[model samples]
Target: MTDHPNSIHQFKVKLINGTEKKLSDYKGKVILIVNTATGCGFAPQLKELETLKNLFKDQDFEVLAFPSNDFGRQEPLNGVDIEEYCAVNHGVSFPMFDKVMVRGSEAHPLYHFLTKISTPRWNFHKYLVNKEGEVEDYFFPFTKPLSSKIKKKIQKLL
Candidate 1:
């Protein structure tokens, strides 16, 4: 790892299977990190996120999804159930992390870093990180993954 303490790569997160992973492993890649809720109205966005992943997976673009129950108790399932739901319903194939608290005092360190850059008002909020692991942009829960605005940003990063 590098000595850059301000980088997103410095954070660690847990995968859906409970495997701890260093964000440093994704250094130099453009990452779209999103907080998802399987039971939320925006759950359908998972499919579009998967589309983006399939379209840019070979271009150093990665989508990392983290389930969160901090909003309206939208994500009620445990890690395994959440993973299975995404895979079976949305065909999600990107890296999915364990359920995390995206806001409040108990929020994960990674989310703390993310919120410092852009506080999420609700579930399905997204943070677009550049190749340098810096927060480049923030998308509200209502922003569609296929929107020209998001697509253009992803294109520029890729």
Candidate 2:
């Protein structure tokens, strides 16, 4: 496991299926971590994220999605329901976690660590972490996942 305390690899998160995942497991890979809400107006970005995931499947890249109800209660689905909706509707192929508060007192520790770098203003906000498990940069909620800027950063990290 990574020894750096400031690194994202130090954190653990729960999957929708209740499996515990260590961020360290994603070592040496560029990761795009996003807080998503299936009901948000920007829900279309889910499809775009899936497209990006597919585009980089041959490389050491991953898109990890976390469902959040922090904004407008936009993500009403929980657990597997959230997973099914993303798959059936947006064809999301990335790993999705259980619903969690992305901001404020109840925010997950990983989100708190990330907020130390940049905070999510709304659903779909994304953090681009480099292969070393440090937050390289972040995108506003509205930034399309497959935008040239996002893709370029991912390529640069890869």
Name the candidate that leads on lDDT: 2
Per-residue CA lDDT of model 1 for 97-141, tens digit only, reads 999999889998888788888888998899999998999999998
- Per-candidate alpha-carbon RMSD to the true structure: 1.8, 1.7
Assess each prediction's global lDDT (C-alpha) against the native. Answer: 0.91, 0.93
Backbone clashes for every candidate come to 0, 0
- The TM-score values for the models, in the order shown, are 0.95, 0.96
Q: How does candidate 2 score on lDDT?
A: 0.93
**Residue 1 miss distance in model 2 (angstroms):** 10
Candidate 2: clashing pairs of residues: none
Window of ten residues with lowest summed lDDT in model 1: 1-10
Q: Give the TM-score of candidate 2.
A: 0.96
